[model samples]
Target: MSDEGEMTGGEDRPLDWANEPHMSSVDTIMWRGDTDRRMRGTICMLEIYDCSPDWDRLVAAHEWGSRMAPRFRQRVVDSPLGAGTPSWAVDPDFDLHYHLRRIKLGGDGSMRELLVTCEQLAMTALDAARPPWEGTLIEGLPDGKAAYFLKAHHALTDGLGAIIGLAQLHSPTREHNPGKPQPPSPDPVNIGPLDLIGRQIGDEIGRIPHRVDLALKGVRALTNPRKALSSALRYGRSVPRVAGLVSPPGSPLLAHRSLSWRFSAFEVPFTDLKAAATAVNASINDIYLAGLIGGFRIYHEKMGSPVDTIPVAIPISVRRPEDPAGGNRIAVGRLAGPVGIADPFERVLTIREQVRLARHEPAVDIFNTLGSVMAWLPGTMLMQFSGAASQNDLQASNVPGIPWDTYVAGAKVERMFPFGPLPGCAMMATMITHNGTACLGINSDGAAVTDLELFAECLIAGFGEVLALAADDGVEPGVLRRVE
Candidate 1:
């Protein structure tokens, strides 16, 4: 599951984006949940470039990218009754000036300053009235370096979906190519919540036959009552785990919640992470989670408040090959992080087994299965599920990155760090292996991770312990270095 997704499209064909007129139930939950700032589902990507892209060309690229993927120009319209998944209508008055921005770095021209600026940019809530996304081309870094921060609502796309969009948006060469396809802008729409109600009702009615078919299938299952009962019992038992209702107890050390966020960035050679994974005979994600828990272990010991285990959540991709590219098709997998294990290999092995079991849950697809119905719930009732993520100390995601070098305008992208939204978790970490480097973007809840400096050091050391497994191969475990 940690294997990266390859670039599978060419310029001749349009991107296989999610072009559905309405948001999926899960997307609806994220879009509406923004009412509670803590539940903001904004995902961001930060790219460090060799130099600032030609401003005129960069602007043209965004205009081109927006045209290639119409969702960028579309905004959500909630159902008039505030029930059911919302509709996506193209903005008749779409303005590129509003969403695209440029700024000069104010502090010392360092990665720390850049990421801190990004932290503030990320923490500020997106405007719900317009498209829930923004882009800033940050100039004035050292060595003529520049960074671009693009923030989007999780409802717009998941990690993988974002990758698909990025892959299309970026170029493989420094030189401009005239062969790139030029897509026409999308047609404007004049629709709102009132206009969506009738369509929503019809869509609900369209599912009546499927519900009846399911009922009929259940009736038929009665002929094999024993088997049906066993299956039902197994599914019933799996529901709690899949829903995260029966997960590891929350660690008191991470009990605090906050309105503010802190950011840290880290990276290492992809080979180092791969070597550790191979040494332990575990998936990359297994090693990734182990390293994170290992850091928590060191942090707890250093802080003098040790915890045995903590609630962790991972997004398991349920996206099938046939599914469209620009929407979430993920199931949440729960883990009881192995903080008590002192050995990194042991922690990795424990996580491998936990992930194995989590992946096989009978109700692993419960989110998507119930999303359609849940999206119709009233605001208060729908929000009750938001607390599930709050119980997690960490939420981690690993996305396979583009293996080849890519360029934006004429600026080469050195590395791309992905930051997932906190969503009440103490921390959210996302790693994307870009051009042989694994760039990690970490966001910590300000109240929970009070000592971010010590936290960063503990993280590097924690990963160092795992990378030590490659000692037999003569690899320097120090290859697991922090970027900022």
Candidate 2:
């Protein structure tokens, strides 16, 4: 099925174009295929649910979907006609017909089987494109269940922004609502050569002196015993408070990933995770990683290969509310997690402490700042090298969701699972809590983590164990322990 319609192009703006190394860094390391042209990140997945068999309602979803393409599509007007160092920004030119795809899974396959097929298909879509985004609605799974799969370039929107964009198309109430007020779609401002190049000049000039000073200070600190001692003390004292900024630990030896991908999901009630955290006085994020650790530990043990500590990466958003409107404002933090711990509670507590140390470490912020300087390298080289580097074992993130219930074409959104990239890593696990439900999306590499289903099961079971512990004692005592 397809919805064909004309899409009005948004106003054109001259984009600021320059070959900044860091800007290229995102392009090189993140992009997966032959051409850098596909820099827009893709968030693709298969959603399974039971829809009423009414023909009219099914038709309406396709019809309503047409009006939505222009809202979410992004266009880059200034991309180099030939493959080159940089591609400038522009508003996406969305085509409803081109973006939305529909196919009926044969009656022979179950919903689970259909989902597996979709995961393999998503992996095949490694190439990039302009105005980058695509969607497919797979209906007619076994037992009256259907699925919706969507992929949008990472450069276009982050997890939170994507949710907001999707919410625009949904009806506010259960009843069919018409003439719904459309959101204020911001106009694209073209950043041309003069604007982009001029700004780059100023930024570069300003950073020169600071860079020199830091370089000198770094050299002096290395040679000066007194200064080095003071810095070490500072690092130790600050580790606990900013531990949230670092990565969780994982084993260095991980399963080998193939070119193909596999997707899996499991449900853990928000109440269960919250209750478990309460039992241990940990935050939702802490509990979340604990579940991941439990899953990882089990995965390793089952394979007869386990490690005491493993390195994990956590993305820390540097985009403050008041920062300028465009470009990437995120940094990566590396932290170690103790997945080898046998006791679930002990592992949770250990992770909580490790995270605390990472959040408070001054080096976390310093490293991010340092990365900006390294961003001066060319995009192609960065991509070539980093792409070859070992992929992180898992990418785990929790994004905040809508406060109230939301509906899409009258289908009550019972759950929202966010599927992120599994690039170079074993898998990417993203969690979003909609209303009262915690929807977990796991995207695993086919070769490395073959048993994603089992991994997800462990996450579900680990949280259950933690909640049981919490039921016995209130969270206050655990909170008090950290305070003291």
Candidate 3:
């Protein structure tokens, strides 16, 4: 078939040939209009990098998106789906421009203008008719570097999935193709309340036998009250230890969050942070938070508002092998990082211990389950309240990376930095390792972190100090260095 003919046929087909969970399950999970307005599924963030290609090249590169099937590539659309499915599902009627937008920000644009543009771009609502994904060719990056801002709903992909998608769109080595067949148009994605209810009914029916078995098992276990009590005690004991890492409400260190967002970025040589982790027997995440604690120390100290403690909420991934990879599969864990501890090693050690202990807490699962339950509320309600409550200080996430080579548009991805949302807090720091470099993306509240450049400088300095301490403790200087 001709290229246009193939594209036309693909767009007409129902996405049934692709993966279809019960339509109800998808409806429940997709981000709904209510949630979109309040919390808005605008959870994803993007960083524009300087590439050597012209505008036409970038647009042509994306045409590959429409040639694939829904299973291969589809955007999510919302319908009056029920609670069982996600609110976002594959959009069969995929329109190229709906996902790709062009914006020029030159005439008198400043750095602030770029940020405002990004935020506004973030706010531009996704078309419920097509899939919930977008790519904007962002020109006018400072220093003449053209950029692209690609965003998808949080319901579509998490950190890992986003990285993977970017990798697929790129190639390890450069090969300029004049043109390629377009990817298939996606199938229709819709979920209504009836779909949710039906899926729940099916789930209940399937679980009857297992639930019965679980009930009998529970009864037997309850008969052995001593064992159960012992297990409970063991679990309870693990909480207070990690309490420093995840302070519950009422902790003095939890800072106030505002409505605005601020952003800054820092690059730490992977070799350095890895050495620090080795010295302290901490993971890269532990050191990442340590660096954050160090930065917060500077931030609060400059404000003359330093506190002895601050609670950080760390989102922990809880996806099991059997779980689907697409949707949210993570949980949050609160830990108190020692901001007051002047000594870097002491702070790292404290974080290490608390994080270690937190692994055993039953409450961690309870909190995660609570988030899942809350996700079921009307999207509008969930967005409004979740943001309202979460506007507290600091969100730190550590997403694993592909240890091997990965590419985008055939450009060798020299680095990957992650920029997470800054809700109500003063700052959000995210770390991702790309080609062995630890790229840190920090989005600060413009008002709260007034001097974005200075904050970025502090992060750079603090990382050096932490790395020095790690090296002093006998960490090999070259262990974590990037291969590139």
Best model number under TM-score: 1
> What's the lDDT for all of these models?
0.84, 0.56, 0.56
Candidate that beats the other on lDDT, 1 or 3, i.e. the better one: 1
Query: Predictions ranked by TM-score, top down?
Result: 1, 3, 2
Worst 10 residues of 2 by lDDT: 475-484
Across residues 376-450, which tens digit of lDDT does each residue of candidate 3 receive? 566566546555445446778887654555433433344555666554455667778776667666666555666
Listed in order, each prediction's TM-score against the native is 0.96, 0.73, 0.78
lDDT of 2 by residue, 257-289 (tens): 666666666565677677777777788888888
What count of clashes does model 2 give?
A: 39
Please tell me which model should have the higher TM-score, number 1 or number 2: 1
Between candidates 1 and 3, name the one with more favorable TM-score.
Answer: 1
Q: Model 3 clash tally?
A: 58
Q: Write the per-residue lDDT of candidate 1 for residues 243-343, one digit (tens) a residue.
A: 87887887788889988888889988888888888877888888788888999999999999998999999999998989888878888888889998998
Q: State the displacement of the C-alpha of residue 366, model 3, in Å, after optimal TM-score superposition.
A: 3.4
Which pairs of residues clash in candidate 1, taking residues 3 or more apart in a chain or in different chains?
none
What's the lDDT for residue 170 in model 1? 82
